[model samples]
Target: MTLSFQRIAYEALNVCNGVTMAALEAAVERTGLAPGAAAIDIGTGNAAVAVRLAERFGLRVTAIEFDPVMADLARQRIDAAGAGAEVTLAVAGAADVLARSAPVDLIVALGTTNVTGEGRPTPEAGFTALRRKLRPGGWLLWGDIVWLAEPPAPLRQITEATNLYTDDAGWRAAATGAGFEVITGRISDPAEFEAYPRDAVTAVRAWLEAHPDAPEAASIRFHADRVQAITDFGRDYIGFGVYLLRNPD
Candidate 1:
């Protein structure tokens, strides 16, 4: 099978998701995650957040990633970070992993809930499903893109087709409807928002230059151009944020 453009791009960039490290650390601190807490990181791209939760916060984390290539890389990184004992890497979709796993003290799903099922689940449904996997009084650190302003009709349709995001108000309502009390939230600064796609494009373009004769070069370049376009245009109307939510007892 041909490698997916997303997989190739993410692997080249060494990051599969967009949230920044600073945002992640801030979310952890805001959530007040305690040592020895049981946490689950859904869609753990490179297990960056998962490893940090385990190492920095002293939490035992179950990190789930659907893509095999990404999962392998996560495994390598987890081992390299010496967090093998504290972090369990699960190569599976979020819904599947949550199904078999016990309720945990914390759950972190950053921009990956769509992988939970076939159809695009609404934010309410997605948040509710993840909440089921958390223990009462537990915390959930959810991160994803949100609209900064209502885009024109064409742009809105284009974004909706790919991103499972809504405006900040809509997101807060969804969280409340899903039984989560929003405690604190952090929106990405303009620089952080620009950095993710900019860095990805840079990484992929560099890879393309170095591996001009590679079989996947065409696919990689195609994906890189598309991302660059989005980075240049779409970012103005959208922003990424991490929300710290609490599951009431």
Candidate 2:
């Protein structure tokens, strides 16, 4: 996707996954992070979650976004929220930030493609890397795609092209292997699952309709159609899951 359109698409979303903001708030509240605690929100597109962390949980947040364009937008969000260092923006890759970041009270990884580093991303790789970055008994709020069943080859190829994910059991096993106790997890409801991609595509369509003559309009539409097609087919075998995990004390 073109960088210009990518920004618009991201701006269209507050939460990348299918779950509602209320659901996320409930999960964060349950994590019991106290006021003035620290947090790092990786891949914080548009900084919605970061803002929420500060506004809702009263946590000091470092909002990380590797893309300069998205980071600019995120900066705008923080300013608009009239927040100070309560939510800081870190415009660096996840691995780079993790290398020097101090352990914090919480980590938010909602739809984050890479948590720990840049090597071929897997559930286990991400879980282990995160373990080293958390204080004992600290929390990790993870959200990502889950394969409900063995997906067909074509669908699998498309979904795994970016970051490798796994089934519900696999996610739990990986976290447990990395010494995290999986406190709880929730799978998206069927309607919720369908809405994620649908909304994304709708955002793109709305952009195209409004900017019919923009140079990148065709490219944007092409990518949007591809996304719509992929999700339409994989809906039966795929879902989004939010898991609350804790590093062992």
Candidate 3:
């Protein structure tokens, strides 16, 4: 099977999501999650956060990633991290995976809520669906893009074409509407927002240089360039954050 452009572009990176490792660790720490807590990481690309949860906090994690390539990569990483025993890796959509697993103390869905297949056209709907799989008082480490300021029409149109994200206040309100209490959230800094796609582009460019004749090189470059463009033009208005939310008891 042909590898997806996304996989080609991001597989080499430790974490596919835009947030930095330090940022992720800080957000997780704020949750005050105890060792041995049960957690589920939905859309766990490369198992970065999943492995951290298992290795650092000793949490038992059910990590779900829909993309086959990503799932395989995650599995490899988990094994290499010696976290295979603590993490159960599933190659399935977040909704499907959650349906089959038991309720957990935490649910983490970062940058892939659409995997829930909720027809409702917003991340809030996805959050609502995932909330059902969380035990009462459980935490959710939700991460995605949001608008820092209302953008120009062109930028707004571009962003709305693919993402249903809103501003920070909107996200907090949506969480409340989805029966979650917003604990705290941290938005990505300008440096992080700039670095993520920059790094991906650099990696893809290096790969292309090494494999000039590869059939997939063009497609990978296209994706990398697209990401870079978005990062370049949208960084002013677009932002990413990890919001810690609690399912109210």
lDDT of 3 at 164: 82
Q: Assess the local accuracy of residue 155 in candidate 2 as a C-alpha lDDT between 0 and 100.
A: 93
Enumerate residue pairs that collide in model 1. Answer: none
lDDT of 1 by residue, 1-249 (tens): 355556555655433556677667776787676899999988887777888888789999999988887787788889899999999999987778888989999998887756446557888988888888889999888888888888777777766774567888888999999999999877788887777787777777777788898898888788888778766677779788778889999
Query: Which 10-residue window in model 2 sums to the lowest lDDT?
Result: 1-10
| Model 3 per-residue lDDT tens digits across residues 1-249 | 555556655666766777887777777787788999999988888888899888887899999888898787788888888898899998887777777777889987788756456643576777788788888888888888889998888877766764588899999988999899988888888887667677778877888888878888788777777777777788789988889999988
| lDDT for each candidate structure | 0.80, 0.85, 0.81
Error of 2 at 5 (Å): 3.7
Show where candidate 1 strays beyond 4 Å: 1-16, 115-118
| Model 3 misplaced stretches (Cα beyond 4 Å) | 160-162
- On lDDT, the candidate that comes out on top is 2
lDDT of 3 at 230: 72
TM-score of each predicted structure versus truth:
0.92, 0.95, 0.92
Better of 1 and 2 by lDDT: 2
Cα-based RMSD of the predictions, in order?
A: 2.0, 1.7, 1.8
lDDT of each residue in 94-187, candidate 2, tens digit only: 8899899999889988777666567567798898898788998899999998899999999999878878889999999999988899998999
Off by over 4 Å in 2: 1-3
